[model samples]
Target chain A: MLEGELLGVFALTWQAAVMLGLGGLLIYLGIAKEVEPVLLVPIGTGVILANVPLGGLTEPGGLFAVLRAAGIDTELFPLLIFIGVGAMIDFGSLLERPYTVFLGAAAQFGIFGTFFLAYFLGDGGLRLFDFSFTDAISIGIIGSADGPTSIYVATMLGSKYTPAIVVAAYSYMALVPIIQPPIMRALTTEAERRLAMPTRAQRVSRRTRVLFPILSILVVGLIAPKATPLIGTLMFGNLLRESGVVERLSRAAQNEMANIVTILLGLTVGGMMTARDFLRPETIMIYVMGVVAFALGTAAGLMLGKVMYLASGRRINPLIGAAGISAFPMCARVVQRVGLEANPHNHLLMHAAGANTAGQIASVVAGGAALVLVPFFA
Target chain B: MAEHVVEAPAPGKILRVHVEEGKPVAAGDRLCVLEALKMELPMVAPVGGTVKALHMSPGQTVEAGDPLAVIEASP
Candidate 1:
């Protein structure tokens, strides 16, 4: 689909060989390296499928095309993916510590911050890596650390930068372990990391559990209409989980449906990685921008955590704020790991999870805000 | 009024429902108990409240942040 002269395999072009090697690397990373292997494996396979000399597999009405039409166009894939994500999420930590909601919002600076940078780099009103107003806005959302939101926004806005944005979102998500630590440490002292939040005494009623997803769906979805599908499917999964019924369907939503959609989504994403599309000066910039976006998000969250720490009279550990970057449980785990590293007695997982879940919701809001604001800037 | 949210202390099954619906209590009150990480973590109410409703019974597994109750604020 992307423009490029078909290469002859027997007499291979260097670009084809290089791309082939890169494709192999992605597969190796997925299979052996285990870096986001769930998504990477299919993405790698798709790269191999698309890049084989004269394969025409990614051609019109081809496998990739069908996947795109069936999976992405109906927006079913992103929504389905969210169901799995919703089941995977534990909102208890977040519900216990409500203040972390603000940390989540603070971390969304990446989306807005990247928008400004991309705009300044190009049209001021904005030009970025060949991105239009919507395209750049979508690309900036890759920084939000929420995969479904990133894909949904890109698809809805019809951004030409989907592949770039997708890769950026996933790659940055995987990099949470690597990217968050330095910023967290630089922002918080060992004493701050060692801060232990007084574990609260609280009990949630069973009725509240059942009502939560329903209320969240109605409240969040109604507030942001475009986000309804995303929040709706997400809450639908949560309701299945919390309702104590339909175990079979819940298992299917969490496992079978999720696994199938993941494979399709990953490969479809990789199909977009042709040399014509991928190997550009802008590609490097997109990666760079993605890294900056992630760094900025981590910084904002950690800084705010410091602010929370001061406000709570050191009851809140600043390290937990780093979890507000939308990487889900991974970022939360990183915060927990770092907190323990600071003090073996220090356990911030629950505190950090509050921020982490908040980040998830806030990132979705940030995506919606981008949809609203970028058009204005344009 | 500040809202109180009951967060899961550990990954576990809620073994007991200690608080009854519509019962008013103090800032510190046992709401439920979760068997998690080899300990019974008593989920307590952070603020004084009339227990509005119950979301779980004994033997329900819960993760962190599943709301167990909601109390309408008493002015």
Candidate 2:
């Protein structure tokens, strides 16, 4: 019995080595490549632990499984993460330029478009990938550029592709730098990119700030009830921040609580990756679809932005429209940087930020819409 | 707390404070500057007998429908 127990302790899982390497890569990406360390670091550590020889941690009642069961399976973790993200976002950047909301809507087309493509590639016809209609829909939502919505929708839809969807969501978010610029340049001429937008004054009232979230929650909740979980958590966090009553909780959610959860969530996510689960033809397809989804989202947003630019008599920067996807500050920063590259005096951050923040809200709504629609379509 | 209603009157970065907290002021005086699309737009107190409150700060972001500073509109 003693010998058997010892043997069990060290018995190597074949994918353990591969998982360890993946973990190390995540760590390197976080530390050296500076790619979303807040999440990747914890996830990387979790991957390493889960893959270790006979860790038993991911076995029945193991640490990662427990986290998944208690938090993820219950859909609690992503909801909580939304609170932190809500607190971090500044909607004034969006509300000031209300029309940017359209850009937000435009960017979401990629979610549906990719869903269509993934479907055709999977059970729809070619049958090249392992995605069921539900999984394809969930995977395509990675285009929303939203972290929580991707996880939330994947969880709710009961898609086996949840881990890959989440990874694709977060990873593509980090890759915004690599994915967006070439597309933006390819779409617009240097002169068009150089076109300067009118500078608008910044003035958000505390009342508007407070009212915005409340109104948004009501509107979106009424429009798409499935989105309530995501929108509610997000608005609740914003309400806390704007209401000024729950400063301590908001601070904790935005800082410490978010930090702790990120670490745990990241690791748990990584734990889901066994070699069999990750290394497949379908996995490669998922990665490809993720990039395509982001690209389509960018193109759709820019197209709508062009309409806005023309309608507004060239008052709006088309580049700012690209920021309407869910990548948040990164997308907004990219738009601003690119705008400046065209014209040194060009300032698009505030405008891009407005669209980027709006993208957060729109993506949630899209997720909710997907949850409602995909079942019927499937 | 209940929400108060207000409007975005010009656009500008909030500069310095004119009225103190829990103070009274009339309309048509200087509020914050409305800076939009790179131009500084100044705003005056609108229909104000006393200052109810100011809702923004320097370097805060805002827009057209966004409320800038609120006034009691009643003495």
Candidate 3:
């Protein structure tokens, strides 16, 4: 009895053992497959630590618990990470092609659509799962295709399935290259994909560049007060970068601040995934819904692209619509690749980057919109 | 003789130059490949012409509107 009491092996439950294996798999994907390694590696480590029998890391007052309370609960980590993301992103592309903003907005239909579907499956209609309005909203934000926004919105809503939601969001985001292409190809004809956009965007004045973040904050904050925190921090970081005089602060936000927050946030998120909490039918459903959310978002964007393509007399390549997800340059690259396959000389990078960056803003706005709507409905 | 200056469409690194100075090229011929935002953007000839001058080489970074090549349009 003494040996059994002392030996963690003897105390290990099947769930814990399974969680340990999952942790190993996450780490393997990070290292071997090189998918979101920065977050996944730390998260995998945290999962391993949390699952070890009697580690107590996830117990009350333990490190994981403390970090969770301080960072995830308070929504500090995701907000700080936004600053880094803002600093790293150059709005130049978006500024060059302002019309792509519509495509970005259209892509957000996925979030609302998936939310309704998830809700209908649960208490809202079929009584299939335990997904609350808040839970459904949290799951749907995965459609935003932005990890920080996913974490921030999920945490704020206090959803029980945040761990599953976070995992699905990050994992599917890494799979954007695979998820977006087929849908992009299916939606656009060869002629639509072959259309080439003008390479040069009209020069944007420095004054306009400096004003963008400020005006964006004012406009978005007024429209969706709940989004103020998420958009505010992001724009502030962009302000720091575009302000030109604060290069040092911008660099710090882009690198050190972002890195530190990512580490803590990743670990906290991973530690939240105890096998008992993570291994549920709802978790599997969340993963499936995540793919649905992405497809819906991609399709919505493509539909808008087709509309704009017709409106523009085929000047616009509908493939750039796929870039309307928040996966950043990956979505943009996919658009470029697809456009090239249709016509080798067709380069859609600039236009796609415009839409991709716009998608970042639109995703945040959608997250804010959910934050507002979910509570009212709940 | 109408001379057209081909400007870099976007800021990026020149990955490969497909034409030499004095090389005759048709419209839409690839002049050079510019890599920007992790995507390869092939700058093509806007009009059929002789390559009068190549202003950029592989590995050189350029900004939007920077002259990439000078094309002397054929009569």
What DockQ does each candidate score versus the true complex, computed on alpha carbons?
Answer: 0.06, 0.03, 0.46
Q: Over 4 Å off in model 3, which ranges?
A: B1-7, B24-31, B42-50, B65-67, B70-75
Task: Order the numbered candidates by DockQ, best leading.
Answer: 3, 1, 2
Q: Is candidate 1 or candidate 2 better by lDDT?
A: 2
Off by over 4 Å in 1: A1-12, A125-128, B1-9, B12-75
lDDT of 1 by residue, A4-85 (tens): 4543456456776777787788789878978888877888888878778777777887888888888887778888999987
* CAPRI-style docking class of model 3 based on DockQ: acceptable
RMSD of each: 9.5, 9.7, 2.1
Error of 1 at A37 (Å): 0.8
lDDT leader: 3
Task: Give per-residue CA lDDT, model 3, range A233-311, as digits (tens).
Answer: 9999999999999999999999999999989999999999998899889999999999999999999999999999999
For candidate 1, give the DockQ: 0.06
Question: Which stretches in model 2 have alpha-carbon errors above 4 Å?
Answer: A1-10, B1-75
